[model samples]
Target chain A: MAKRLMPLLNRVLVEKIVPPAKTHAGILLPETSNKLDSGKVLAVGPGLRDKTGNHIPVAVKEGDTVLLPEYGGTTVKLGEKEYHLYRDEDIMGTLHD
Target chain B: MAKRLMPLLNRVLVEKIVPPAKTHAGILLPETSNKLDSGKVLAVGPGLRDKTGNHIPVAVKEGDTVLLPEYGGTTVKLGEKEYHLYRDEDIMGTLHD
Candidate 1:
């Protein structure tokens, strides 16, 4: 499981949320639309230290859903699943529910 | 100047440093190699707030030479020059020079 992948220094490990299967006029929609800009937090990095050497924790936690940019992030492939590693600040925002 | 491009929320504006020109056997090399992995900080965003609402400042400062990843970051084009905006945590490390 990519959940074992621990990000270092204010990074977050996320698994992109898969969009629900959809059909248009009884025909399946293109797979391209399956890519979503949201994900579930899998793992988080030890927060990075500030100039004063104080540790600043990430805003989001494991199990939290977050908004991801269309680009950026380090891709991690574990078995058949894909995960992404993003700096804490790379996450645009967190989604409730 | 991209220096005027202000980044928000723990983002940084960086001007990529041009690699030293190299010539081999008097043949000018391709410009592709000029794309460097390092840059100088031009501007910085107000630090992001932690879960507790405390602001965490970025580690580096303007004029600081920083290491940048080959991928990621938002590209901003100003005139004929190209700049990149990266989150504070996206900066890999600081280079002393």
Candidate 2:
């Protein structure tokens, strides 16, 4: 049996998306962006419980592309790939296309 | 009227306590501690709104001493004093005596 990761309490697991090195016009891309990083949501945790004990759903679901902050997140290594864990609120926004 | 800070959404306003340079026995003290900083709670936020807009009360109240993490907090300047703002959950613990 293969091990699986299940995030808890509104945490989201994401795999970063590496942008292409050059544009179609042959313009080189910067190594890093100080503002945001692109990633795909791998897993979503059950929503956090409010004071009243009601579950609050997370903002994004599995397979959603999201904008991530340049810094701050827990790094998790599963097998050979690297993943990041962030609070639902830390995910900036979802990509449309 | 003087300016007042009303923290919102489970934020806390605290004034850092500067420990004495030397112990009662005359041992010199270090400039900073990596573990925690002592602070007095000046104010507490109304509490973060859950998905359903329910209120969740903060853990500590004004005048209580608390343990603050070594880093990560918003600093605010009010009048001639400096204060720090932290999420209610970020506060480590309440200090006794």
Candidate 3:
């Protein structure tokens, strides 16, 4: 978001939503990288071609919270932070408030 | 083409098109597995859900020749043959007759 790094052709750009620190049941919580499944959508591709060669728009839009797969993505760096490029389909699901 | 391995929700099943052996310039060609990019589509997902909750329909259909990525796929075994499961977006392109 601070930098421009757009994904192409059914691909989506996302940054993993690292968990916040907390304490629960007298235990320090979120010490581990859990919920790697969650990420913030950054940029998206212009959609891939369809049978008739028309674009079949990507499902998620920028600023949307999305579910990410544990594996599979092309890591990229911008400024100082890292982002990932995942095919829109590889994104497992979308999160809503 | 011999198994029932329907890929789920934007997934596509494919078997790499291994090049046939041949001789060229007194050298045996296709011995090193070049053009692994080509594949035969076996089965495809019924498409993934969209923002509206309707299926967005997979781009490629069964029996289409497709281009495969160098990596990133779940290997599957059926009988004596091995197949691959790729998200439809991971498929780079489709080959036509």
Candidate 4:
């Protein structure tokens, strides 16, 4: 049996997208240029209940690329991979193209 | 014109209640003994709107004694008094007795 990560109550599970290690010219890129501020949404919660007990869905969905804040978001390590769990509101915005 | 403090969006205006400087035994208390965790609610917001646009009023009301968290809550100054503005949920609970 395998365990799958499932976000709960408007939480989002994201995998940090690390920038490419080198340029197309075969030159090593500086670590400073590799700002790990973007992530790919791996899973999303089933939305939170409002005051009236109505469900309000999160804005972003799975497979979306999102901008992350410099701080916050709980880091979770599963097996050999590391993922971040953030409240839906903590995600800055979704990236297009 | 005299200005008044009015909280908005389910926020509460609280005035910290500092403990008495001296004990009943006529001994002065140390600063460490004063936790400063209690407050008196002075004003409350009209309530925030839920997803369905329904108003969700704050639980605490004026003159209520509330327990506060050690951190968080924005400091507000009006006239010669200092107050704290906190969201309804940020207030730990209402103190009874």
Best by TM-score: 2
Candidate 4's C-alpha runs over 4 A off are A1-51, A54-97, B34-36
Q: Which stretches of candidate 3 lie above 4 Å from their native place?
A: A23-26, A30-35, B1-97
Scored against the true structure, residue B10 in model 1 reaches a CA lDDT of 79
Q: Interface root mean square deviation of every model, in Å?
A: 12.5, 13.6, 13.9, 15.2
Better of 1 and 3 by TM-score: 3
> In candidate 1, how many clashes are counted?
0
Clashing pairs in 4: none
Per-residue accuracy of model 1 over B1-97 as CA lDDT, tens digit each: 1114445567787998876566756676677873548999988876776655576897779899999987887666543467777888888899885
Runs of candidate 2 with Cα error greater than 4 angstroms are: B1-97
Those runs of model 1 whose alpha carbons end farther than 4 Å from true positions after fitting are A1-3, A23-36, B1-97
Please give the distance, in angstroms, between residue B23's alpha carbon in candidate 4 and its true position after superposition.
1.6
Output the TM-score of candidate 2.
Answer: 0.50
Q: How well is each residue in A1-97 modelled by candidate 3, as lDDT tens digits?
A: 4578767799999998764465445545535434235678888999976665556788788997875666899889898988889998777555444
On TM-score, the stronger of 2 and 4 is 2
Error of 2 at B70 (Å): 26
Question: Each candidate's DockQ score against the native complex?
Answer: 0.03, 0.03, 0.03, 0.06
lDDT values, one for every candidate: 0.73, 0.76, 0.72, 0.75
DockQ of 3: 0.03
Write one digit per residue (lDDT tens) for candidate 3, span B11-68.
7878988765665555667465564568898877778665544568999988899988
- How close to the true structure is residue B78 of candidate 1, measured as C-alpha lDDT? 40
Write the residue-wise lDDT of candidate 2 on A7-73 in tens digits.
9988999999876677678977655422356678999998787766777778688998775655688
Q: Give me candidate 1's interface root-mean-square deviation.
A: 12.5
